[model samples]
Target: MRQLLQDLFDKRVNQFVSDKRSKKLFFPKAETKQACLANRSAEIVKVKAAGKIIEESVEDEFQTIKYQAHYQYLIKQNGILYMEEEMEDRLAKFYKNALVMDEEIRPILESENDPETELNHLDLEDHTERLSYAYDRLKAVQYAERWWNSYNPAYKKFQNDCTNFISQCLKAGGAPMRGYPKRDAGWWLQSNNWSYSWAVAHSLRLYLSNSKIGLRAKEVSSPDLLKLGDVICYDFEGDGRFNHNTLVTGKDANGMPLVNAHTYNSRMRYWAYEDSSAYTPNIKYKFYSIIDE
Candidate 1:
């Protein structure tokens, strides 16, 4: 009888292994096609913009053309940054897959009657602890020196590097990438492009509510605020060419806003207006607050 039972278990195990192998052979893992397509499209857009800039040989040109080209380059770089961010997110998800529970811990808690079952709440707590541990472990792995050494030259560009770093922080904090709209420097360079102030305003509106970050649009203002993570946008000329953006990292000793941004000559760095070369002439800036719920 014991021999029969052992044979039965062996059969089951063999069948499970066969099924797993078959699945792997028949259906390979899904590629990140959506992200790849977006990246490719962005590249095409960049090439077209570059072509247009090259074709323009008129000796007498508007002052704004230089600004337009600068913004176009910015958008192209932003597209690359977005793609890098998606790659990091995919890596984080791969690591997280191993730590997620196979069963619901909540149902066990709600249905529990016996003392031992009630103590199962500890199991739920343990799940949360495990998730945090997994997140930390994944982040460490993702950011290790070995991983940095493995980055290809294309991925080593400044915008991509900064966005990848930021993506790691967001993932570690348990934030998903669903709500924020994807944007690039190209979006700002078009002739009838959306205003920088409007883009920041709308993005802030979506982020505050969607991110559960407690801040609201009605609360945003220039003098009354500007918190860490708040967004500031510039209308480069008083004629309403809203063309620049920066995120508030912190305040200076004198209570002025310090920002991080990418632009024509300025890559990524924290800057106060007094120290920034990207400061616009004859322009009024708009400030949008990000409320953390």
Candidate 2:
């Protein structure tokens, strides 16, 4: 398993530094990564990967294994270099200790954005007492970078964790939580209980749109207008049901947002997500500037 992963990362590093790509290897992801880097005039100076087996089973001479591969990249742009990390979940099959098939397990998200089918109500108990909140962008971005590739022990880790992770970033920025005990109401997470807005991509989008009190946001016209700690919701299929969310952690040399997200566990990635496996021609995005007063 270690050698297999080593070979995989070796191919990835070669592809990043070489102009000629091997068709035998799965190069779509590599192509995307390179394109995103090129757009910033950046190149990967070094790459390293390590794998950890999550599960394994052996039947006769055939084996199936689930593992996670962590990739660290040293990227150089302009005159500076920095590190970025990503984690991918993979399933591999081996026959008599020879690797056969290795495939990435993409995230499968649920649809919770349709107003005709899903709940779109915000049950705020207090309408007159508006809380004074100040959003700390630095703290939010720091939290995002700190936990981009890992899960916090204090929160319940969900299979679809994009929104839950973004909610945590917002909370770290001092966003007050309200509307507890109701699943369809304000943005909040209390112990094992949480509002849909606190964890669902679509629900959080709606909450940010309708929220006028604590922890609210303003819908921005463009991604460039968003500052650090802002949120970007993704409707991968452009079908109105949001499936993913990310936090703005940094900006490229061109000033485009470099986001961090869970689920795929990416850091310092381009906000457009055009190279994403789930990306489609009809993808849609909603940019929200976090409101702090």
Candidate 3:
């Protein structure tokens, strides 16, 4: 009887676990679904005395306001700074009466009468390379498809795994790692340790834009213009502050790019993530092409 039960369990495991398993996830339990939709708030040291409203726009059913705060904030792990983003906040005021949606009351934030704080310049080196990107699109796409469900053992898993997974895909495409023992800059992965760009979506965006070599990008207008290995930055709240990233892995019969990302653990998913919990009526997106020469 024990042998019979063991045989049944082994058969189930074999049927469930595979390198080509479906990336389309479906969690029936409420608790299981909540785990995939959690968003990490900023780790700010000193919040702004008064946030300056930099930009504001109203979409079909929601209003988005981009505010820059005066503060010092950094995401540091083990006393080393990984990434320091601009202290900013985006407010998405939803008009509940506009559409038939769930009940959500996003509190509006108010700024004080103080002026915007000054920022100091840090002496950072700038490295420029005239070389072209040699990252193989086929390899990155393959790696993404293979490991989208089951993670590779070589990399470190984080609470937010989307950017980290993308970094692995980029490395599989022959993007060399840089920076060791320090987490302030460079997209490096050594001894299972990785830089901020390898894990943080916002930091990866900055690194790709500012990189001199290895990886670089140019912003495009829409996802339809993106190539096989391009990236799409998701501003689920329609704010300028992007919070999620996905890689283009496949295209459908209509030629729309199907993307893959982690955290929610999706593979070859739809590019327009209207199903995301953070998605708002005023959601915005930025498309970038990872330039290869």
Candidate 4:
């Protein structure tokens, strides 16, 4: 199934690149196009282009695919059923806590646009106080390994581990999960089981669409345009379906963007473009930033 998914993804990407509509409408800007052409020409001249090396370096930083196959196989064999269940349950708890955190930070988000009003409300030296509040709220919700161990062994293994962590981050940042069906425990709880990808994706969509959070989606070309709390969506293999999602943490020493993601193969890890090993061709990526200001 994994191989099939990869092949299908690759085929879709190849078709997309080969399509005339995509070539004309979706190509990078003149500057980026020129750079791509120049790099290709340089590769032809010396059979070794420095830019190609750099691209390879960027792709290599992500090592997700190496372990994805193993996990996929385990899932297929039902060997990790218990672990997956544990993860789902733990994720549910995490989501519950995230809901609470969002409530606690409501004042901060409400005052995000007005620095003077925010400063007046809190006794602080500068923006550091608010920033520290945000950071501490985020840190307090992060459950380490011990929290994971508290779950049943079976429920811990095969879940969408990265999305679970990211959900907490989103809540810390004041994005509450809304519009979910009511359950005995919470308002956002759903009776149906959702894929990890779906849970995170829908949660984000809900938050952005809600008037309270006020995150407006935007079109972005390069990772450089992304901010610390921005969201990146990937159409792995160039198909219309956006399958992967990540958060932009910051930039690396070489100025490449670093991402936090829980991918099928990579689990949870920091990734960058310089690592070619991480690049899966035919993926059309889109970015969106939360509108705090």
Candidate 5:
């Protein structure tokens, strides 16, 4: 098992260093990485992989192993070098000490749907009070850096945690939360209950677009318009239902955003997400600049 994993890790590093997309039947991630690198005028100058077997079981001469493969890519773009990292959960099966099956375990985002009835109940007059507050961008980015790969025990962790994680970052920045006790009305989380906008990507996208009071944002025309501590929402299928959200933590050499996210926990990653397994040719994005007043 050790030798098999070593060989596989070697191949993974070679694939990135050569800038050739993996031809392995189940390797869509490698293909996506190469495609994204090309789109960004980036190349992998070096690559490294570290693997750990997290679980192992055996039955009837067959051994099944669940492992994590963490990769670090030294990418060069516009004459600057940036290190991007990601981790993958993978499963492998071996029979009679020979490798048989190997595949990535992809995460499923929670279902995408809205409660229209709840939206209708929201008080439109709520916006008449434009409560002013200061946004602490530095603290927000600090929180993102501290918890990108881990869950905060103070909040309820969701199966699809991207939006919930982004909400935490916004709250850390002093974005006021209101319309609590109503799941669809505003952006808030309290006592085991959370507004849809606080935990759902699609709902948060709508709230940022339409809200005029607390925790409001302005939709930007492009990703480049986003600043540190801003938010980006993704509709990977481009079918109008958003499924993922990220918080900007840094900028690349070309001034494009580098973001941090949970669910598929990542940090300082290129914002485009062209390399995401969920990415599609029709992927749509909404860039939002958090309003601070």
Candidate 6:
């Protein structure tokens, strides 16, 4: 069944990606098109001259072949969760390649420009809770290890483990899991089942963004503002589709946050992931400063 689901997911995602890539030739912004051509004029001319091909066709062919190879490589390395990362890698690669045009790539990084969805926010910013509350970083770190190493031995394991791992860390730092049994409700982990926010990355993003009472978060503008016990959610595409989560465990001397996560079983990994196929030029991130009581 697991194999079946994985195969189905791969098929659906490959089609979805192919569809998105087919629409990649348009430049969403005039400035983006000019800047890209100015930077890679030589390659653009070469591709245009090579087969007397239309610029968009040359760019399209390059992107399609490059992206397919990248996806295959990701599956070879990270077999389990390569779908989101594959698109991310392809996005970053698209911008760096000279064979592609600015308009062809910038649309992927383009935003909807809607204020409500794009704004960074702090819940209960003027609340009286700030003075009296503090996160137990020690407990949070300790609990992170328990989840990583299964020291607790009781919390249920998950197929999609990233969000589950982050939730355990939050509970350690004192985030209350108010809803139980109701999957659509707010974050909670029952014995064998859990809330959507406890196990799904997109759902958790919404839960924290809209949270009003039990546990809320302040969305920091950058990962550099995040400290130990803070949370970072990943949207592989520049669009609002979040697919992964990690907990901050430590920082480098350069003040870069080192993260710990489950699904891939990483410990103290660098927070800015540029090498993975899961990174995109339009890669959007949510850095959450958890409020603990």
Clashes of each: 9, 0, 1, 30, 0, 5
Off by over 4 Å in 6: 1-134, 149-152
Off by over 4 Å in 5: 19-28, 111-125
- The 0-to-1 C-alpha lDDT of every candidate, in the order given, reads 0.29, 0.83, 0.56, 0.33, 0.82, 0.54
TM-score, cand. 2: 0.90
Candidate 3 regions exceeding 4 Å error are 1-125, 129-133
Tell me the tens digit of each residue's lDDT in model 1 across 105-182.
111101111122111111111111111112232342233212332333323223223223223322333333321122
Q: How many Å off is the CA of 156 in candidate 3?
A: 0.6
TM-score ranking, best first? 2, 5, 3, 6, 4, 1
| TM-score against truth, every candidate | 0.31, 0.90, 0.57, 0.39, 0.89, 0.54
Model 1 segments beyond 4 Å from truth? 1-176, 179-219, 264-278
- Of 1 and 2, the candidate ahead on TM-score is 2
lDDT score of residue 74 within candidate 6: 18
- Scored against the true structure, residue 230 in model 4 reaches a CA lDDT of 64
- The top-ranked prediction according to TM-score is 2
Candidate 3 lDDT, 1-293, residue by residue in tens: 22322332243233222222345422111122223212222122221123455556667766454443322222222333322112223332335323222122222211121113311211112465444458798899999888875678877766566787888888888777765555646777777566666676666776766676656778888778888878887767765545678889976444567787766556555577654555678878778888886
The lDDT-based order of candidates, best leading, equals: 2, 5, 3, 6, 4, 1
lDDT of 2: 0.83
Error of 1 at 51 (Å): 30
Per-residue CA lDDT of candidate 6, range 2-74, in tens?
2322332344334422322244423232123223323423111110100111222124425322111112211
